[model samples]
Target chain A: MQGKAVVPATRRRRPSSPDGLVLLLLAVPGIAWFSVFAYGPMAGLVVAFKDFNVRDGIFGSPWNGFANFRYFLTSGDAVTIIVNTLFLNALFLSASLLAGLILALMLNEIRGSLYRRFMQSTIFFPYFVSPIVISIMLQVILSGVGGSGGALNNLLSVIDLPQLSWYTEPGAWPWILTIVKVWQLGGYTSVIFLAAITAISEEVYEAAAIDGASRARMALSITTPLLLPTLGVLLVLGVGRIFFGDFATIYAIVQDNGILFPTTDVIDTYVFRSLRTIGDFGTTAAIGLFQSVVGFFFVTAAVLVQRRFHKESSIL
Target chain B: MSTTGYNESLLDHEAREADKPAARRRARRRPEPFTVASHIVVTLFGLFCLIPLWMIIAGSFTDETVLARQGYSLFPNPFSLAAYELLFSGQSLLNGYVASLFITLVGTILSVSSTASLAWVIARRLPWISRPLTVFAYVPMLFHGGLVPLYLLVTQVLSLSNSWFAVILPILLAPFLVFITVSFFRQLPEEILDAARIDGAGELRIFFQIVLPLSKPILAVLGLFYAVTYWNEWFMALLFVSDPDKYPLQLILQNLIANVTNATSLPGATAAQAAAPVYQLRFAMTVLTVGPILLAYPFAQRFFVKGITLGATKG
Candidate 1:
């Protein structure tokens, strides 16, 4: 038996066989897809190191290493993009977290399972509604009179208040975008937090009750303490993607209206416009590489911090 | 583990029950204040979520000038089917509908299966390759060279520039979908795969005949994600395809709505031109975009919550 098993095990199978190459075959189509569309673009990153004339081509171009980096640092748009992206993301993250947490807590506290389920579904529905749809909806609602359908104007008129022009105005967009983000994600985010809440030991709440605590007190002292781990993990993950923006949201809402640039021009939109419309592949690649490096460093740091904080309990 | 704490809290609340049985019963019977508050809050939010949809549906039924003045009331005013008439009346819209449906159908089927297969193979703890492959897949999410080279590769190298494949291929092998599937397959019982092998079935046979069928719930979830992504994706269509007949629903909607808005504001526009059934068209197309998914969602939605929660928790 041992001799027979050894003979079968040692038999070298043909790697090209349809059966034996399942993994290879399974991977090929996807690998080929990425190789061309995703990874092929890595060649463009070299443009940052070269003068990048269309005539010279990406590989044949003479190198001017670090010049692009230097140029980026000096450019005022760099500061604007960084500051704008960070601030917007920070606001979005905090607002979403707070609202999601409250919603989750409230949902968890409810005894009626049906209502909770219905609410959860409704709230999550917005998340599924594409950003493009949301953009058009917002345009109609926020368009001031003598402008378009201006639903908000109609609502305000009912209360005898003045209508506001939401478009062509940069100041209100950050708030508007933040609210939209919360609306889109609050219910979805709550699901994760609610899962964490459900995992909390009932005995801890019982112990808190034994101390004669009110529901509010129990929530503050016992529940929040247990949820810290989940919250920390979420915060770290959010911070990791601080350098990126929702390209769909930004593109749909802003849509070539350069007036909104100061408030809404994220690194993604800037890079896309530079590459597609202006035909500046080199600069776009340079900016993309810059964004990636910063993102990589920050994500690494965030992961390290998460590991250190919840060494054993952390799911991620 | 935490259930013990819950039991204790109930016990504490139940302390001295005999002395105030009526009060205790009332306390229990009256229901927690949180219950009422939760329902109220949730219902209000549900309405908040539904309002835009309601507005869109209502707007789609009204005249353009009526909508322009009323600004999307919940009740239809001067209700008209002119928008629907104009949309279904046109040959272009009908072609767009057919194109979008075909793309979504074909794309979802191809993308989901390919992604699942790749995900399953990589999900196994086979040799050193699995770990490296996962890392390789994840790298694109972190840093990608931007659009130009990708465009060149698709058009020049792959020679799929104007073909529907340009829109379909790049999105088919999404790392995010693969990551989701790998996470899903990782949770399945390894013993099932072992059992199939022990029964003398080939690996391919086991994967298709055993594993794929068992993974339907996750497959459905990923299928929905892919379908929605395909449906909403007008950017790729815009970049790659110029053929009006090849244009998907979203690209067509984008052109129509943007043009309508522009035309309404054009300096020399007449009231008739401004009110030329454009507002209703905007809402009508919006309805068309969301119609399929919304109809499909109620069936698969129960799976959605569980899938997302599981993926989130596991990650």
Candidate 2:
């Protein structure tokens, strides 16, 4: 009976047909998900082509060809906005990675398991805090109002320095934002790097110890080199996202403060203000398209770089 | 029984550690003492995380007038419930809180269940669909057309603008949640799925009765993740809803903070009262807003630590 069933099964291949259908079925949910949420809105990109008007609506808006794109490129603030975005992202990305790695290293050295667990849990709580909350917290801390009103400003006064208007000051924002980003994200990022660190075989450390290597020396020579692939992947992902910004945080914190626009206005915030405030959908979409395309290209480049360095371990 | 067993093992570990010097003598030399500087460094970093939370709590309790005068102290000065009193005063605040809770609860349940079902199907390696489906699931994570188009799609195209559905539906089919679910399903043994099939069980029956029951760990993780995301979400509310009644707690808190920050003065009061700090109010509101999550997190800390490690470790 088994032999007879086998011969028929070979002829019919029941699993193959239904399994193929199953794969097709699985694709349906994901495809449908992206189509509605990710790709469906892509049609609105056409608003960038037309001189968009609320009266005309998104689709019925009149075509202005490259006029929007031209306007965006020719705008006086374009260079300043683009450069500021790139600069801030570079600062933020590098600072976060460094801070995260340092924290992970510190956590790894912790002697007691309970203490290590406690530290991990406590530090990671901030990662879950909303960006809006962080913005609110920072504003209160930095507002520099005196006679008990100011946090940082009061500290400055005690040291005989003038209180800086943090909200108004563009110069100090880059540093402040970088620090804020690091504080919130470092704990989260450290977990990833820490996992990579722990996944390193204990036998390798044991071997190095037999060779009379110090813990610090072993960490530098053995652990860091081994963890490079993980770090490389992280770095590439960050690089890929350089064109886009964390709009929620930046918009909530910075708002319409024009003085800070030169330092704090990223592509996301710029496009947002352009769309909402100026009612320039076409130009804003053009800028959005520009960021997306550049982001795609850079992300592709980063993946390629990761593949070159780490081969199969690279996410790409 | 298992809890008692765990305690016994922990006690055994203590006993073994107590004999460590005897073992070390046989090994010729003990490892160097842990560096004192490392302890200092770790302690400082731990305090860095703890202090902000303490300040937020301190600020929330501190009298608004005294807070205005004192800058934010770790110690609550002239402690009062003024901020809390004012925060909960408006009907909209109560409505926002209710709306947020309902959305988060409903959204997390629906999102986690659907994602897990799909993940179970994909993880079984049905030989025909897994690879391509996995690729399709990951694409949304990397590329998205900017916010305007997405917003327009949600509001105008889908006609969900100002509707609670606007925030809830779009977030329901999150790609990250699906990916997390898939990673979890992959960790489950194929034999269980095969055994179900051999028992002549249908896919839906097997999933609900068997697959889901065994997936508590991942479910807890993904549920918590999606819950937090839904709770903290305000940008969606800001974009889609104009009605204050429909706003989530985050958005309500955010608007209040924004208003206070921009107010520049408490103009109705006398000069001395006006001079009293207002920035603390924003901090206070933020503290009140995040209070629920902070209170809840300690209980779930173990789950979060494990869940986060699992989520990020693979990706």
Candidate 3:
């Protein structure tokens, strides 16, 4: 009986044909939903090249053949919007990386488990807070009128410094937005790095200690080097997303604050404004297509490069 | 054993290492100045994170005159419940709450069920379907047709505009959640599944009766994620729904904030109301919008941590 059982287990039979069919049936709803929502829109991207009239409809519209693309390219806001998007994303990426790494290293150095966990939870709280709320909080804290005697102004008066109008200052928004982004995201990102640090085998640290390596030396030589793969993957992914501005954050914080538009406006807000205000379906679609294509290429190139260097960590 | 249990054991083993022989333990636990500096820095940073939330709460309860005069304080000298009274007095706030609750609860259920079922099928490595299905799932993550086409599809084709369904459907089954669920389902032991199959349990039975029962933690984690996302969502309403009555809490809060800010300059009853109470009202609205999630956060923090660890390590 034991021999027979061993033989059957070792020579495990293929699943029956009907089971395969059952699995397919189970997957049908998800597939159908994706087909409508995801793939169908992908197929509809052709509308970007067409003059999409309501009467003519999506596919029925006459082909305009790059006219939409030409319109956006020539609009002159294109360069500013794209440049703002890339520059802001780059700034955010570096700030968030630096802040997250510093916090992770700091958190790792602390010895009390309860203190570490409490700090981790407190810092991570902001990631879950809505951008809308953050915007409101910012207004309350910074707006000269909305926050009549706003917190910042109050502090400035106490310190004998002149109160500055925060919202109207376009020059300050890039820095303000970068700081807010880092504050919101740094802790959450650091948790990833912390996990990576924790996953490092203790034997390596023990061996380093035995060799008379100090804590700082071990962290620099052992922990940081061992953490390189995780850092590398995150950095590559961050670069890939350089073109994709966070729409929610930008929109909520800088809403109709036209003075700040020169500095804060990004590709996402540009497309959204065009679509909503001008109701230009074709041009908006063209810009969307441009972003999608560019993003796809960037991500693919990153993944390829990642695969070349560290095949095991390549997402694909 | 649970992943947390495994981690705790690892930590315990390290602690044991530090507790061994006095000389070695002292060497390991050297009193470095950096430790003191790090604690100070981390504690200050933690306070920095908490201060905004603290201000929001304090500003909400402070007397309107005091709040305007004081500009938000750690402790409201003259506390008032007027904001709460105003929030509760309105029918609109209640309506917004009901709309948001319905959307979040129903959306999370639909999202979890669809994502889990699909993830299970793909994770099973079934004949002729798994590979293509994976590619199908992943394609959306890499290449979306962009928001224009999706908006067009939802409004013109599906005709779901001006309804709560519009808010729910767009976010129903995110590819990221599907991938997370897939990775989690894959971690389940294959031997147990084979044993169940050999016991004549059908695929449906195995999935519903066995796999789901074993996946409580991951499902709870994913459910909290979906709930928070649906609860926080205002973009869908901004794009699709126009009816003020159907506006979710976040959208209503957004509009209220805009109105309050705009009212400050305009001369009218709105400006009169905006003079003192508006500051408190803004804080009140913020608290109301974020209050439920904040209250629930500590209970869900464990699962949230686990979820992040799962995504980070596995991805």
Candidate 4:
């Protein structure tokens, strides 16, 4: 009985046919996928250290210790790329969390379920939209030329404000990205918080209602505080990937726009350009290594914090 | 115990959202400032999310010259389907749709099955097997191995360049989804599994006949997630696939928008048909590409809402 989990009844009788080994068949595909795609890349990361040449291949290339890192450092692109990544992500994370919180609070207060669902459904549409489409939407609003201009320029002209080239405006990209981030994720984020708010015991609300507490007071006092743990978890998870950014959205929106790179460029985009346009695998891989190493630190912190909060069910 | 708590929270949410008729029937009290403000805020925010979409829909239907002159509007004063008409007439456009549908359907099935199977093995807590696999899955979440290696392996080593599998294989297993499914599976009654084992039901039989049927909720959640991912995939296509024949709808739309002259004109359109198709055509393409997801997401909303919240609160 004690060893039942290890040795099945049928397996005990058939000594040659081990159920333990057979059970492993289920995991073979996954393990193979992990080995080839996931761990396989880790081994190939050695290309970062070498001066990789097409003729000589990844290994045969001469070893250049830290030169790739040095070039990136001296070129000053490293600091800018890292700063932009952190700054943009920081803005996105804080803004998204705040917007989500507010939206959730508002949705929770709506007395009518049908209206609430309608608003919820409307807002969640962008989350499902492809970034390609989002980029097109951005262009439609931000193209800023007569006849070919989008809505924003028309609105600006209506207000008698000057039309400017939105694509070339580096100063405006951070804000644009933050707004885009919110548009894409605000509903999804709010839905999670709404669920947490929904999960709050009904008795607490009932008690408050009996005590003649207004809806706002209960929301700010009871709901906000109750959502903090969830907020903390999301924050930690977000902070874990601070060194990384969404390559798809950024690349889709700001494809090869050198002028906007001052604000919109991130580690992922930088590495991609270095790979595709420049064909410098060593420098690109070095930057990737930098991102992963720094990212790993925050990940450690996140895991440590999650462990303290939910020891029995650490997500990592 | 934890999973029971997690599941009950989801149930509580459903029960509250759907079963609160009494709240609606309550006597109308005068609205407070907060309540009024909330309505205003929610309405304004909802409009902000919606108006751009409206602009595109209107823009898509408007005449090309009207779109160019008026920019995009919330109203299409002169409606025309020339963009859609021209787009659908192209052979490449049809191929893009077929490719995107095939990839999304096939990718979702492969991804979901592998994810579920891996999760089941992990949930069983099988001593020798599960621990290492867990670490293997988990480490990628913490530290990515960088794109150069991944790209090189996909293109050079695996040689999946120009192949659809290059787009599908890398995204096949997300560790996050695996963990969520594992947690859900672990919550299933062990007594049922034990009962099946005692009745001489093999592991695979039990998995097929029992486990999968019981876990439809998580499967739906994950299936939608994967389907959306595969449908929206263009970056992977950009990276691995170079052939126009294999371009998904997103990739086609991407290429169309990036340079309206390239694939935008399409092969079969006459000079007159190709003329003046940029502004309105993009809006039309945007509508076609995103329309399916918009229509589908609403139906799956409840499941994803439950799925994400469960994953979130449980974390």
Quick one: best lDDT, which candidate?
A: 4
**Which ten contiguous residues of candidate 3 chain B have the minimum total lDDT?**
B263-272
Q: Please, what are the lDDT tens digits per residue for candidate 4 over residues B91-160?
A: 7778888888988999999999999999988877776777777888898888877999899889888889
Candidate 2 Cα misplacement greater than 4 A, ranges? A1-30, A144-149, A308-316, B1-34, B125-128, B261-281
Top model number, DockQ: 4
How does residue B186 of candidate 1 score in lDDT? 75
Q: For every model in order, what is the iRMS?
A: 7.0, 5.7, 4.7, 4.4
Candidate 2 residue-wise lDDT, A18-104, digit = tens: 444643564465567667887776667887788877777898988989998888889887887889888989998999898888777
**Which parts of model 3 have CA positions greater than 4 angstroms off?**
A1-14, A144-149, B1-30, B261-276
Share of real contacts kept by model 3?
0.50
Candidate 3: Cα lDDT at A52:
90
| Order of the predicted models by DockQ, top scorer first | 4, 3, 2, 1
Residue pairs with backbone overlap in model 1: A201-B2, A202-B2, A202-B5, A202-B6, A203-B4, A203-B5, A203-B6, A206-B9
Task: Give per-residue CA lDDT, model 1, range A1-316, as digits (tens).
Answer: 1111111322222222444466656667667666766777776677777777667677877888887777777989888888889989999999988877878777665554566567778887887887778877777678822364388877888899977767878998899999889888888888778767766656565666567665556556776778777888889889988998777777777888888899988888787777678776666677878887888887777778877986643333
The residue pairs in collision within model 3 are: none
Q: List model 4 lDDT by residue over A87-129, tens digit each.
A: 9999999999999999999877676778888899887778888
TM-score of structure candidate 4: 0.94
Between candidates 1 and 4, which one is better according to lDDT?
4
Q: Each model's DockQ?
A: 0.31, 0.32, 0.45, 0.51
CA deviation > 4 Å runs, candidate 1: A1-21, A51-57, A60-72, A144-149, A206-212, A309-316, B1-27, B260-275
Cα lDDT, all candidates: 0.71, 0.70, 0.80, 0.81
Residue-level lDDT of model 3, residues B192-277, one tens digit each, is 77776666677788889878877887799789999999999999889998887788888877786667655332212243464537
